[model samples]
Target chain A: MVGVRVDGTTRLMGIIGDPISQARTPQAINPIFAGKGADIVCVPLHVPADDLATVWAGLKAMPNLIGFGVTLPHKQIVPQLCDSLDPLAARIGAVNVVRREPDGRFRGYQFDGQGFVRGLIAQGVVLQGRDALMIGAGGAAVAIAFALQQAGIARLVVANRTFDKAEALARAVNEATGTSFATAGAPTPESGQLVVNATSLGLNDSDPLPLDVSMLQAGMTVAEVIAKPEITALLRAAEQRGAAIHSGIHMITGQVSLIADHMIAALG
Target chain B: MVGVRVDGTTRLMGIIGDPISQARTPQAINPIFAGKGADIVCVPLHVPADDLATVWAGLKAMPNLIGFGVTLPHKQIVPQLCDSLDPLAARIGAVNVVRREPDGRFRGYQFDGQGFVRGLIAQGVVLQGRDALMIGAGGAAVAIAFALQQAGIARLVVANRTFDKAEALARAVNEATGTSFATAGAPTPESGQLVVNATSLGLNDSDPLPLDVSMLQAGMTVAEVIAKPEITALLRAAEQRGAAIHSGIHMITGQVSLIADHMIAALG
Candidate 1:
């Protein structure tokens, strides 16, 4: 938690979600504001799905609120509510953050994919011309898949339990990027240079691995999207096979600064 | 300023007003929450008049919000927007605080008058059967006037620049309490046992006294409603006239704990 001295003049920001007690954005970003001596405080708002529209209208009318972050059940539905969307966010059909403009219009932006890519790059992992195998066709997978393509990946094989959803995501990415760079297929850990577990498989100790750990190659790199355990079973197996590993925590650490910067830049 | 550690689980309360930068509630009440080690934080929300309805809707939908305080232009209009109001608040047609029930209904409560009377009583300035001369007939004056009658004040003389407004307030209080203990009249400093300066005249240094200080006798006690410049010109002159003077800061000090207790009690 951040030590904040909130007063009448302090600017406001928050993360809106249902079952919001588990959200970490407030703890992650409030420290950045405090360190910079910025008079901004980020709190959590537990707004149910039915109340989003009413809450949004009130947020717009708040003169001192700079912006707020969207999470879980809200990312996809929030884009339509935004006054404008970043071109990439529009193409991806999801938004993870929204900034309030001086004219009182809210512009949405997608940072999940960008955060994943930035996290990998910051860790010195190469993405250009790499052949990657991504598991799952959920929201996180969709964002990461597009980001991998944008980062100059030679090809991407999207693997999921429901093959139809995976194929749909691959086709959408290909159509938007104007390249035959994505395909729907089963996860082949031995063949791909990079493997990403974007599913919730690693969240619990009893959960099965998203891919074949035995097929993991010595030179391959395995990454995960489950942040709670930090070292997921899949990543542990991959490391034992002499492969490099990346934890899902980086996705959050990589975006906290970006989220704070986006909201502060709009203040000027 | 209170040092607050804000996280997702912290319950929220705030002060709502236009030009809210001058509100002292946040600074006053947050420390009480922190002192009790309670996971409750009080912030400030600047909601303009036109957006009150929209903001009120949003606040009701926030599951983690316990309640909020209403100030300035909002105090009088908020009662009608409430699902229910304390009988005294409805009678006075004003509310300074509100609590959100678990069932989602918002109930408004008035504490301004109680606070003023409590402040005087806390300092051992007796109110039982006292003859008092109260200046001004504004919102604060109205709350204080009704409270004084409830506290068993023998008689209350309501005075204002506009005589009609004073008469109307006196008539309303008398009718509601079923007592002929209040009247509309000019401020006669020498006649009353207690003199209350409820007008805004004592706010600025260059302004005239709410009543003639020459007639303020040694036995009479003078009280004020202006918190800033704790000792107003009227208070200073009354002190020089050998009268017991009470500063306005006690009103806030007297009510802060009461407000906090009201919101927290509903949480159970």
Candidate 2:
């Protein structure tokens, strides 16, 4: 209980995921939720993948539940459940946070995109006129990439184990915004100003490296989207290589605050 | 920003319902969630009836959501959302609350059944050896009738506009609880000692009356489940006739504390 909750006066925020015990949201954002109000609390809800519909019927029935953050598996599914969704959230094809209204309706939003943008700013990394290397083309990676353009990154490259998925995502983002800030390939010859690893690899104690962190260079900013086991192997390796590091924890904290603020505003 | 929330030291509780705004759980239970260092905050989550599966998926994914007092439209549906459900909730064919664990699994329980029993005891009304009259076979009424038997009522007569549903619910409670208190049809000849109106007979300004006080005896006790218009016409009439009355507001308050306690014990 000592480390589980925030002090009084904080508002409430939460992230829902399957296998929630392994999530980092509880540890990273509960404090921030408390910091904002000392009256707030952030909780992690583990909703099963199969019974999503039935449980949802009952959850929305409770008048006291304010809003919730969605995670893997459910993230993509949340958009379809919304009566009306944020344009960006719908375009991103997933939602990491939702705002519940007085009418028992949930409006979906993708905070992860904006959160990462805020993260870059927090670490003094300027996104404008910068070329970046983003590893993986998964949900988190895609969301982060979408957020990157908003932060003014001029050019980008997306590297992944599966070239097709990466290419599809890059093409989608490019086609949607016509900004052409993202691309797909293997570890290529083009150097980048910022490099980010978004895959789950390098997270577990025994997981393999998803990307060549060795490709990182001096003066280049490196970031890892993995929050738990806070210092993933790739991040440590990046640090060892003298690359400036902007941890994903910053993104999580910023996102929690942003999501809570958004929900509060929506509620009002 | 200025309200109670469940943190590490706080407990968790919820009031489950769709269209949750019409319910008043935050007012009744938030104080209790804060009373014992349990940073409980009740949120109003509006789950669309069609998107039930998605809502459940979102809810089960979080690690912090605990118990809840489920409400209208979802009472019957909540039981299916759980991996394990209370027999009483299962028997009543409904659930009003669910308990989530640290591991993120949700277990369903029907607190309305027990809360109603406690409401009777708090008023020093012993159900044992006392004949009772229950009006309506709706969600709340069914729960109250099941609870009455648990309190040792001698016999119960269920009355409803649709007499068949009331008779059916009475039979269901009798079969599942193994209590002989349930009976078909409405109370006849005013023979019941304890009369209860669980329908929305006296709500807002012009709600219809469900019970006829014409045959009420002076020593009999009458209870109403309507929270607003606390002084219901039936209860008021019973009071005028020198009969004791347990206002619906008392039931609402009792249920909130009961649910908060359930969460504290379950989550702690």
Q: After superposition, how far is residue A117 of candidate 2 from its true place, in Å?
A: 1.5
DockQ of 2: 0.13
What DockQ class does candidate 2 belong to?
incorrect
Ten contiguous residues with the weakest lDDT in model 1 chain B: B186-195
Per-model CA lDDT versus the true structure: 0.87, 0.71
Q: What are the runs in model 1 whose C-alpha is more than 4 Å off? A: A121-131, A149-157, A162-168, A178-186, A190-194, A217-220, B121-124, B128-130, B152-154, B190-192, B217-219
Q: Candidate 1 at B37: error in angstroms?
A: 3.4
lDDT of 1 by residue, A1-268 (tens): 5578888888888788997888899888889888877888888888899999999998888788788999877887999999999988897788989889878799999988888888888888889988999999988888898889988889999999999999999998999889999999988875548899999998999999998888997778898878889999999999998899999988887788778877888788
User: What tens-digit string does per-residue lDDT give for candidate 2 at B123-226?
Assistant: 78768889888888887787888788878888888888887898888888878877666887755426548888878778856775676677776778888787
Candidate 1 per-residue C-alpha lDDT over B11-32 given as tens digits, one digit per residue, 9 for 90 to 100: 8897899988888888788898
- What local lDDT score does residue B96 receive in model 2, on the 0 to 100 scale? 75
TM-score of chain B taken alone, candidate 1? 0.94
